[model samples]
Target: MENTKSRKQPSTVFAVVSFIAIVAVLIIMINLGVNTTLSVFAGVIMAVIVTALLGIPWKETEKNIISVAADCMPTFLIVIMVGMLVGIWMASGTVPSLMYYGMQIISPKILVPLAFVLCGLTSEFTGTSFGSVATMGLAMVGIASTTSIPIPLVVGAIVSGAWLGDKMSPLSDTTNLASGVSKVGLYDHIHSMMYTTLPAGIVALILFTIAGLHYGGNMDTAQQQLIMNTLADNFHISLILILPCILVILISVFRLPSLLGMGLAVVISTIFGLVFQGVGFVQLMDYAFNGFSIKTGVAIVDPMLNRGGVLSMSELLVTFMIASVMGAIITTSGILDVLAKNVLLKFIKNKSILVLVTLIYCYIVNFLTAGGQTVAIIVTEQTFETTYKDMNISRRVLSRTLEDAGTLSAPIVPWGVATIYVMGVLGCSNAYIPYAWFIFIVPIFSMVCAITGIGMWDADEKPLRTKKA
Candidate 1:
């Protein structure tokens, strides 16, 4: 304790300056066309400088950086596992089968809700919201043209469903990133989010049904049927292909290690590919590492299926490592501690306000960076991490809240990266933004849970303010 007292804490202004400098470097580097890993590394360098200014020695900081990296090793492995699982599952005909069957759910009465479900399932299956938008979303928008339903509403359902699955799916880089940042088990993080996500999903579906039922007549399903036929022609589609996904879910449900589950699924999927798809072992291994590729001769279907590999998700290795350094530096140099004690603890009177501020900051970062969900999640998670601990709130809350605002808010921002891509793919406009109900609905549930203490499980010390009785 005497040795601890010898170290000086950074002042509030210094802490604030350190944070701003890191964020500025990140934003500038990204805008200048730097890759995400390098941008985060730049921010990490800024943090190292701040730590030096705080009078911490270089050796100690280096150790802290390595320790942070080491701590993240499991999550890193899980991310790779997720990627491999996706690739092999695709090769084994799992993903294609899901897509083919999901397309069968569309009917005139529930066209809007079907679009949302189909997009959500596609994204969840393949773990690519952008792909889902380009494929399912494109088809949904095309079919809507033959109906009286508003284009914006169909686009909104597509956007909401795509983002919702991206936010929740284990295969998503963003989801795993959130899990790693908050230091929770991958499945634990996903399960925790269901508190907010499940209800929001239900509400969004109800609204879509109500809005779409009046206009759900005489719609053409030509594009949908074409895509299904393309999938059928390319691969043997079957319900048995769903076992891989079910295996992952059972792993989550039974509280098994995610790595074991993912690895097991990869092995099982490899066997399935051999037995059912007649894919060779060496070729399957190649797909596992490099991702699956196929020429279905369809514009959207090809892009959607040409995804998932260890290399595809390897970019996170550097990004997560560097982002961990940023978190460790600010934490070790007492930057976040100072900021929290002097500022956050003062303004954030209770858990409700704390949760609200986190949600807003996530949105702000996403908006300012024009859809840097990785930046938004990692930065906000680091900034609020220790504060959540101090307030006796779980860090899981921080992860879930960031996802609610960061991931969901991405496509809704008219000029954001996600929205731009969606527009380019579907030829839709900002008219879809207002109808993206899941984005709007989830945050409301997050706030309500904050106020009511519904999902706000206790951590350690009692909070300054208690939840409503």
Candidate 2:
């Protein structure tokens, strides 16, 4: 038995080492200005190395690769559809009308907080940070350009609001994933997160509001009106466009599947486009694939409103592929397992340390994976479930930590899926935004709550009794 274990250990170590080397090479290539396509190739190589090193039967790894590919196929279709939806919506005047109204309400003095609230509302309704950013959040960027606000800060506020809603909303995939992985009830997880999420959101709003009042500069009303008029010329703007968004919110509130809810919204938007804008089938198809382009002959407005389509999903696809493959390799190599055994388990002796360590580990996993928020929550929950139980801590606490750290941190990491999508739509860099104040503050605030036992259930709580029994 000892010899068998020893043989396995070497394979695991070799697998981890090889995976790390590939990642390092990819990083170097990226630093050296190699195209993103090459970076994805590097990730694929790393995945193969991990499969080989895991000592799984060679045929099995090949099968797994096929499975992974198959699983990813639907994502491609969804991405394409999303692109088309965005394009049609833009060309149909849905987006422009929304933007026109948004611009009328927002001035530089209130842009930051207003953006936060708007993004927050949209994300909650959409249940997808990516969808919200791609649609309305993109419009916010155009609106911001008419003001003297710092672009990055505006981007940050948008990110902050979107992620906050995504983390807290019952409809969010990450929220469900955290609860599911931890074996906690969905409502319980959401209720627990409110302790941290609400405080952080309030703080973020206050900070953004202050910044808007003090640092936000004047707006060019002429330029803003010009952009609005250009939008009016292309598509029919009406209150009817608001129905799709409202339908999304209603479906989400009923706890419907996120994909279904989003798909419904897409259908509504398409119908609205066809009926109101006289959009042809060919045009709709073209818009979805190539994105909507507005030829206003005005350089700035064209670029701003002329983006959306399956093609826009390219950067996001690459980012997801890289991060997912890396995560798969990490799982296969047992490096993550070893880290949890050696590092995470060691914290079980101290209640406070265990919570702190779990929070930190979840945060690091999110940063490294840069994939979906679900990946971090699942990994962290699996890593620490036994420890939490052993320490008599509630799983809800763990679930809460997962949200506060993992779910909220995705948008701050440049290569992360949310960040890449947001940046692509906004036409900015991830680094452009100051680290979202909410993202930075939420985890710290949550850790404080955990250590001080502020929001934690009492040891004698009924849930603990049921769990222990």
After the best TM-score superposition of candidate 1, give how far the Cα of residue 145 lies from its true spot, in angstroms: 15
The Cα local distance difference test for each model comes to 0.75, 0.72
* Model 2 C-alpha lDDT per residue in residues 65-179, reported as the tens digit of each score: 4555565555545555566667777867777877888888777888888888888987887677766676667778878877778889888988898888888777787888888
lDDT of 1 by residue, 245-321 (tens): 76765664565665786778889999999998999999999999898889887896776577667776665555555
* Alpha carbon lDDT at 384, candidate 1: 87
- Which regions of candidate 1 are displaced past 4 Å? 1-8, 107-203, 206-220, 348-469
Instruction: Give residue 274's error in model 2 in angstroms.
Output: 3.4
Single out the weakest 10-residue window by summed lDDT for candidate 1: 460-469
